[model samples]
Target: MIGLEGALYPWRFRLVLALLALMVGAIAWRMLDLQVLDHDFLKAHGDARSVRHIPIPAHRGLITDRNGEPLAVSTPVTTLWANGKELQAAREQWPTLAAALGQDPANFAARLEQNKEREFMYLVRGLTPEKGQSVLDLKVPGVYAIEEFRRFYPAGEVAAHVVGFTDIDDRGREGMELAYEDWLAGVPGKRQVLKDRRGKLIKDVQVAQNAKAGKALALSIDLRLQYLAHRELRNALLEHDAKAGSLVMVDVKTGEVLAMVNHPTYNPNNRRNLTPAAMRNRAMIDVFEPGSTIKPLSMAAALETGRWKPSDIVQVGNGTLQIGRYSIRDVSRTQGQALDLTGILINSSNVGMSKVAFDVGGAQLFEVFTKLGFGRDTGLGFPGERVGNLPNHRQWRQAETATLSYGYGLSVTAVQLAHAYAALGNGGAMTPLSMIRVDSKPGTMQVVSANVAKTLQGMLQEVTESPRGAVRARVPGYHVAGKSGTARKTSVGTKGYQANSYRSLFAGFAPAQDPRIALVVVIDEPGKGAYYGGLISAPVFSRVMAGSLRLMNIAPDNLPLPEQKLAAAGQGGRN
Candidate 1:
């Protein structure tokens, strides 16, 4: 202290200076390396820890019916997310935050503990805006709300099968929603931001990408008709005590589907109890034997060969048909002594149908069936749309061919039947069926000449007007034409058909001349006293088709109740 130079040791002083210089040099070299030599690599590593590339979710599109009623909509919603570490560090704020999120504080703490290693976690995936803001007002560190969309169906189960639905992540799962997913889902966007170690977004670094909202979709479905079909199908199922049911209606002019419904359908909005059984769209996915409904088409095919006439008579003695060892019988059939082509269709005689099918031959019958949209996808682009089984004509045995004529050897979906019958209404030209609204007209394929279609239309008219026709199928103020079918369902776990299990179906078009609408109704395994298609399915078709035709403002072709003494004036009683 008396003399600093005299007291200080030179060697120790030199050593200290050298140590300071070494430290300075080491720091300078590190700065140079970071600033120039390895600058990009270091910066990247730093950014990895402090910067986050966040997803900017693009909003989804809307779906509307042909009348512009919203069937599906994407509503804005907020999702609450959090950083596990930060949320855990602020234990004092846990109760407030958990309460705002409607979660128990103790359970939330346990969840935080379990996911401590994770940097990000979802607290609530979908929340209303009000609820989300309430959670953010708590000011809990590391908690954030991300904007997203929740798909909602306005028509509920009434349009469930046609409109389909989306999952919680806003992705299509079934029906038309899945069929046009690419067209409805828009491109997503992205952005970059700076975050602190605790995972709080400090500032926006840059906009990495821009977002694009999804395109709106317009369907060919008429929501009003859909509701009508849905309600009528449910009522029929309940009245008949049926196991299941399906219905389809199409615009004959454009082949646009107006309504498609299935019994036991689930509510798309409430997805809490979903099952494969309830979700199955029987109209487009399942197939069944069509019974006497095939009579008209068989006649059409025979007439195409120029060998059959509407006036040609067939002897349907005792109303029983025999082919090989298999015998086909009707349900208490009358007017069986002699039936012309029109009378055979009107009465739905199995024996008469067999006779006509034989005249057409197996190859011709197969061609007619294939041309009617059986055994192939209808090209509606719906997921799980079935191509109903139709064995090649080369495999047809005498019994098989006869049974096929009566709708036993082959099967057809409700939509397939609608497609075929709609073609008849559209001058024998089958147009491509569509679920979405089209800007251009759909193409058509001529399956039969217009002359044949006119002749067939007249014959079908007899089905509703003849003294021994399906009286229940007639709409009082309109000239309705359709055929009734009754068939036995195949037994479970067995190849043969069940005696008591029956499927009832009615298919045809209305305003008979200049037909505008065609529909098919199928009820499976009716447990009630009446299981025949005329008794079960025809009444439903009458109500729905009549209501629909009236709603569309179509001019009535038949006389009003007061003027028409038809019901009182010798109208045919149902068989």
Candidate 2:
């Protein structure tokens, strides 16, 4: 029995030894796999949990006016973010964090649950630096703040349509902002970062790339003139109870838009309730039949033919001219008169201009208008600028030509009108319009003969300087030259004109001896009482021009009765 027991013990001991050997082998294999064979895989998994590629936000550039006044500036702000998985574990701290973030606790929890699968989530964006830092002060796990930029407009609604606004992500959405996005948007950077198990940032490991700050942009707009235009336009809209209005002032020589303002403009800084209508830059976007404001262009076309002179008499029999199923009539006051070129303009004579347009014919008129920058880009590089319709001359009939002469059967934007008038004031030289400050003078094209442009300028002056003229547009100390246009608005879904709706317009330049600036005012649907361009838009032009001339330091040309007479004599006026 002793021998059997001893043999059984040995067998048991051998079995135990074999089992221990197998366990040691398995442990050795696991160590070899982890330390060598699967080392890269394990390390990669660990890095995936703790190492993150963090984005470094780049600063956006500034937007300044021509005088370096800040129109749009980037203010540093904070964006609160979190790791949803890690944040869910710290549910107890959610209430404190949410309260500091100005979010309801229940909503915060629900948001966390909604984004639980996401490693990164934004809690709030575009908070002020102080407000964002206060939330970070709570020291909540899984919560973080990334520095970002929020665009602020100093001019507010006054320059909103020009400078435009950026989205919450600091992306340009409209105006010069959107037009120059690539020039303004900077490149973001990336860095490797180390984080703890709770997704809290421990350290910035290494910067993979450096952020590139955006470049600064300077616009051609003068803030002072912009404010003046804004005030005058807003006042006119309110006074006339108009639907909307737009004003554009241009330096006739430089082709720089000094001020462009639109009524119903939105506050770029706060666009919570922004509508498309309020955000539209109508001075460049809206198109209308320019009415008698275009008669000067027609007269310019006539004079360019060399067959008609400013002194040539146009026989108007009873103020009406019939052509191809259409009858054009002027106001009864100036009917049945033998009006010359200057007289035609002074009376705003549709019949007389129609006769001149017929003699000049369609092709010559179209050529002149085309050269004057109608139906083309203003070279502003602005977004959504409408090229108003100027139908091909080949498409014109006698009726269409007459209507076009009187500013119908075609459309033009306020910017286009301002540009054309600027060319007229610049002695028939058309330059590229600019929305940015020009370091050098822009190249110009001879759109009309200098003699024709000079003669036309004199006639335009007579429209405002004569006894029977647009006296409301006259600036006190300046000799103003412009035309008044009371255009009937086209029907919405039809071809005819709206009976009562009209677009009041005035396009003119000041200090008529040496034209410095050209301004155009368009008031749409003046509903309160007045609708004539002489009544509604001309006054606005006067007020704005007065302020603008003062701001520009242009000497009043009409000062001193002797100088006025000398200037008028040199300029060749009828009255």
TM-score of each: 0.89, 0.89
Predicted candidate 2 versus true structure: per-residue lDDT over 425-513, tens digit per residue: 99999988989988798899999999988888888888898888899999988898999999999998998998899999999997788
lDDT (Cα, tens digit) per residue for candidate 1, span 412-435: 889999999999989899999998
lDDT of 2: 0.90
Q: Which residue pairs collide, candidate 1?
A: none
Structure candidate 2, residue pairs in collision: none
Which parts of model 1 are misplaced by more than 4 Å? 1-49, 92-96, 104-106, 560-575
Alpha-carbon deviation at 463 in model 1, angstroms: 0.5
lDDT of every predicted structure (CA atoms): 0.87, 0.90
Decoy 2 TM-score against native: 0.89
